[model samples]
Target chain A: MDAIAEKKPVAFNRWLPYWAVFQADVRQTLRSWVYLFWVLLSVLATVGYLLYRFGSYHEGGIVQTASVHVSQLLRWIVLGSAAIVCVLTAGSITSERGTMADSVLSRGISRYQYFLGKWHARLATVLGTFLTLGIATLISALFLLHEDLSLDGSLVALAVVAALLTTVITFGVTVSAVANSTVLGIAVLWSMLCAAGFLMSFLPPRYPSPDRTLERLPYILQGNYDLAGLAQFAGWSLLASGVAALFGLGYFSRRDV
Target chain B: MAENSSSNMVVETFKLTKIYQNRQIALNDVTLRLEPGCVLGLLGSNGAGKTTLLRLIIGLHRPTAGWAKVFGKFMTPNAAELRRRIGYIPTNPQFPRGMTPITYLDYMARLFGLPKDVRKPRLASLIRAVDLLRVSGDSIAGFSNGMTARLAVAASLINEPDLLIWDEPTHGLDPEARRSMLELIKTLSREKTLIVSSHNLSDIDEVCNHAAVLSHGQLIYCGSLQDLKGRMRRNHFELDLEGEQKAITKSTTAIRALPEFKVVTLKHRRLELYLQEEVGGAAALANVLMTLNDNKVTLVSIRSVGQQTEQAFLDLVEKEESRGFARIYQAEAA
Candidate 1:
């Protein structure tokens, strides 16, 4: 037989690796009966809490302030989302090393591809889970409060919250990639976020006595809530997320093991 | 397209040297080449840079100096195209814990961009090829080491790469599984160039078309396996004779009178001697042997001394270690 020269087709774009990783991540995270159970149970608990609080206020013949209840519901949603995102991000990359899937690095899969695939999978998972849970919480809050939330002056507030969530997602991923184990990644990420919160609280009081500039931080003590203040918070979150992405991409690209 | 054997240098490393900060040199100025469709073995003991060289070839780590290329492409992870053309199997591969082989392979196949139509059949075929058909749907948690290795081999082939690099591929396998794995490797060699790094010489001897011995990050020997065997052959012959000691001594002395018999030992009725290759004095020694025969001496046996290649390997390693990398590289180049 005559020898034939051939180019084995490499049709998948570089992004294809990300898709592969995404599938693996989804299968790993969601296929576990425990996680599925957790998702359902957590959403139900949020709904029940919303109903109980509203029902209690109505029976007591007390008019619960709309602002207080709305803030409380948002707080619960943010806190719940934070915990889920942390759990999801903690295992994305570090756990892969524990599992030997890092062999993909040795097997002609670029570390960059491996990392991106993980990031995409993780981004999809955390964001997808967050959206699901966030919507469930929002719906429960809306039914109880009987208020229509609109995107008016709240645009900047929305941006700040989005940015904060992005920062958390990227920061958690960076930690996961660098950490030796999943538990260690989780510990480091949460510890750092907690430290950031504590440090922010200790910042010196604003120089302008009557108009305290330190009131601008999101979820901070002492502030006349406004979009401009939220804008500044959004700026910090964006900066943090961008810096995290750079670190994650750079380190994952060059790591040898 | 017609095959171009001249251009198919599947793996080429030129003056590759890697020195870690810990003062250990993993690879030292190692220049090598592998032709497409050739199965080459990188043989070495522990800490011998076998894994290091494979890592460089796969572009997992950058070379400290010189260059390495796989499938004729430069050694860089950015050469994603080249990675697609090459498959790597680590000594032990780690798959996602709960997923079955089929799910993992299917996912990888899709990532490699095999259409679902193409992926399903190909995945099924590979799973069966590795004798993992029975457990394709089962989680990898319970698989034996050999089964895991077989699954790894199958996964590496998902992209149908033209080059396959295996680092100690048969590391932990039962004898039967090891044999099957080796045979599978041989079968794969027909369609792709392969680089197998192993400390097991028997594995290299069984399947490798060419072999290189690595010790302390230096390539001490590189060539055909037959050439390696030939190099270690003894340059002497033993002759067994049943006779009086005096007659054997007389005959030995007569032979020693010639320049070819460098050393002679008389042990019982056996006389072993070192002889120069292509010696002209064999005829003279035959004449003396004839005289001993006439005097009623019985020539019991005559055979070449047996020297194992494994012994020569040990000697090579010792010699390389004593002189160290500096001398080993010089000798290798020479």
Candidate 2:
């Protein structure tokens, strides 16, 4: 303290890869009981639904009589697991502010890198879950329905689900970055989602056919796809998520940890 | 600005100020320079801006006015390269509850961009250094506070940083754990420049050679610990005498009459004499002994009791309070 000397910045290679944070977050998310429980519940519900559909088959063969819509099944599963995704990602940044931020941020990583890394990681988790559900739905359709599901159709449906999840996860991350506590982050995100869902339900139908907008909204329940509708879905999803992620980065870069 | 070229200076600040969103001024016009390889004890009461200053240096908060430079680089939001050279252990270090210490450290190493060849050996050595070898595989959720703190130390050292900052490192630990933590800090200080912020004066006294005292977001004093104590040392001496009441009373009266003695009080068989500032304690004691001898008093023992560092710190804070700065002295009392 007594002796003051000239200061010089220490030179070092600064490499802050988003992949590092992404990998760590993925491992932590997978190990969490909440995530594991969600996976188990989703599997059981899918299997049980398939069993019920199989049991309902009449004199006709399972291939022609049984009705097991893969898109509708995935929609229900995604809705069921929404809480888990929200709970896991809603506190990702806010919770770490006091706990691990001090150690991690004090190192050679920018706030943008940290936020992006986490966003990518959580998005990856949701996408991975959707992929697994897709495979299971396909298998159940092939065995129980005795119908060959088109790989291209399944991919399109999966893409729609992935796009929707990206928006949800990005919204959660934004709230987490801005909120002061984990509870607050979770509360804000869930409330916003609920309010949005409630408001969207009130809007009058603009198209002649109800199925037209349903295909474009990125809902997993709708299996029919028009190229225009899918393109609109992907564009809106990316735009919303990109905007939310940018907002999160903006707030996080300036806020004190 | 020209002096910023020297590599020996680890941290430098110029009029650094931080005002929270609520309008609370956490730090104000604080300008400090810290050299490398010195263990600096940051002494302050709670909310006295110790943590605020540390956060600014570590780039956790953007300064409201002025600026701080670490390793000669201004600490901005993008100063990631500058931060890589520093290791920081926060006041409360936390991790994902389910991860083990070894996994956590490995994660930290990867975040630091340590190559695989380097990370494995470094991770193993840090685990051994922090003495977490046996339970390194156990989850952090089950770790005691002390174990968590030890793990934090290991994680911060994963990159072998040149500057290490610990905020209340020994806080919330039992006596034994506190001692071990201090010993670890002491050992680390030998190799790396260290900054330790704590309310415990004795902890600082045990480990820090240099000290900076903060009061109400203002730095009141900053210098070597010995110099600070020396500056605050009082000119006083105590003597234990075995004598009759009459002799003691006579000696007190005689000692009081001496020109060198500023204040004299006698209680029981002990005597305390305050000498003039210019009068050295040794010379004043010599005069007191002569006065006692003349009264036929027997001197049992004599010694110089200068003010301890704790007292010096409190006195400095009190002086600052007198200058109209608010003081949070209850932390010191605790």
Candidate 3:
């Protein structure tokens, strides 16, 4: 009891639990075979593209070369990693047998912290894999393409892709937090994503659809994309993510662990 | 109402109830208060709501009706500050995959916001204390049930919590592990308030002063362990008598002829005396021994079974069930 009284003054950081969950979850996800397989695929695809590009000499304009190269890297991340993220995050809460109960029941953590901590951990890891591929492609593209790429364009394009991945993961974790079974979570998440993708495709470019984002990436990287559309899409993407996050937090906080 | 009611108690439940989604009453109308320095042993048969009651107190499961207060504050999912003063271990405790004992305990310490100066040393000491130093670096995935249970114990203690709540702390443990765990609980009982839930009555009898029994999601008994044991209607007595076969047989035959001593059995050189409720325990036991001595039989040993706690618990549950308490929750009736 005296020890506890002494500890009372040690400055308990409110965010420490969230950070702990984030760090541990990132470590776990990075070491998992499934996430590792996705990492390997993204790596191999980027390397294979670089080999093909550098193997032959072509004066294709820097814009075109960079666009195609960006597409190649983003191909694995935006298109392929969606399902991988679903598999990885859809069970973030539901798959836990008793670990969630154990951690939350212990000293100093709210279920909200645990849920958000895991949510961001998935965000960081999936984005981490994306960054690995993005940087590798950009570094290689600078030397092989032998043209001054638009730095602003590349950053913007990368940010958009990052935003897209974040949305995918947010919804995936939302499904995880809501569903009681990992398998069921995966099914619901994929269906939600597919339905959202379909709806976005039919709507105008301002709707922030995955297809629209990917389709406009070349122009975005060339600095010729529509700014109004980008702003609208960014706002809408952010709003969608916020809504998903709120729903997850609400349900997870109120429901039984 | 809950806040003002249990200010002086370590744990207070006010008509606490929990009904699962399927309309199953996992806990019903359980109201009890525990003073500080009290070690409460939760007892029940299978599906007896022991886990449910503990979970409700720990704020793991929201009650369907009523509420619980720990340390004078209401229990809720977001009550981090309140929970910080409590250490909890769920039944069949599970640790996250891809972590070793060292890493997991460290994570638990960090969850409590322990500074590095405290967290690092504390985690190191806990791992060694739990006898996990040998496997400190190995992945927890390979640990046995006993090893995992030990790690769970370490995790629960990382915060130096004032109140410890454990659900089935000795469950699934091998004999040696179970003995060691009960010893740990007994030692901690001297310093902190604890609520331990288990079906093992002797474990409770050994470590707890206060006891609560549940049957079919309803509290059947709550008070001192001695009081609960005292509820038994009759008592058992056993003896080892050494003498000539005819002498022992003649002594046992005379004892068996008593009207009050309904259960008397003799085999080999041992005699068992079961005193009915109407029989005076001390007088009946004395008469039997005197008869043996008068017959020139040597009293090698004499003892009474310590299983009265088990029998007393069974009696409570049976009494509750006999009132048709379970029939109220039957699915067909619902």
Which rank order by TM-score, best down to worst? Answer: 3, 2, 1
Clashing pairs in 3: none
Candidate 2 wrong stretches, greater than 4 Å = A1-17, A58-68, A146-149, A197-224, B1-8, B233-236, B242-246, B256-269, B274-287, B296-301, B304-307, B325-334
A1-257: candidate 3 lDDT, tens digit per residue: 56555434556778898899889888878888879988887778778877677665465433336666676577567787778778988977887635555564455888889888989999988887787678778877878764545777778778778877888889988988889889999999999988888876898644666786787776777677777777677677778888999999999887776
Off by over 4 Å in 3: A1-9, A53-64, A97-100, A146-149, A204-208, B1-5, B144-146, B239-248, B276-302, B325-334
DockQ for candidate 1, C-alpha atoms:
0.40
lDDT score of model 2?
A: 0.79
Scored by lDDT, model 1 comes in at: 0.70
C-alpha lDDT of residue B46 in model 1 = 91
DockQ of each: 0.40, 0.48, 0.59
What tens digits encode model 2's per-residue C-alpha lDDT throughout B147-264?
Answer: 9888988888888899998999998989998999898888888989999999889999999988989988988787888887876646667899987899899889888888888889
lDDT tens digits by residue: candidate 3, B246-314: 999999999998766878999898898888776788888888888988999999998876587888888
Choose 1 or 2, whichever is better by TM-score.
2
Q: Write the per-residue lDDT of candidate 1 for residues A103-146, one digit (tens) a residue.
A: 55544356677777777666676556755665555455556754
TM-score of 1: 0.79
Those runs of model 1 whose alpha carbons end farther than 4 Å from true positions after fitting are: A1-10, A31-55, A65-70, A76-84, A106-109, A145-159, A179-184, A202-225, A228-232, B1-8, B20-24, B233-309, B324-333
In order, the first chain's TM-score in every candidate is 0.77, 0.83, 0.88
- Of 1 and 3, the candidate ranking higher by lDDT: 3
DockQ of 3: 0.59
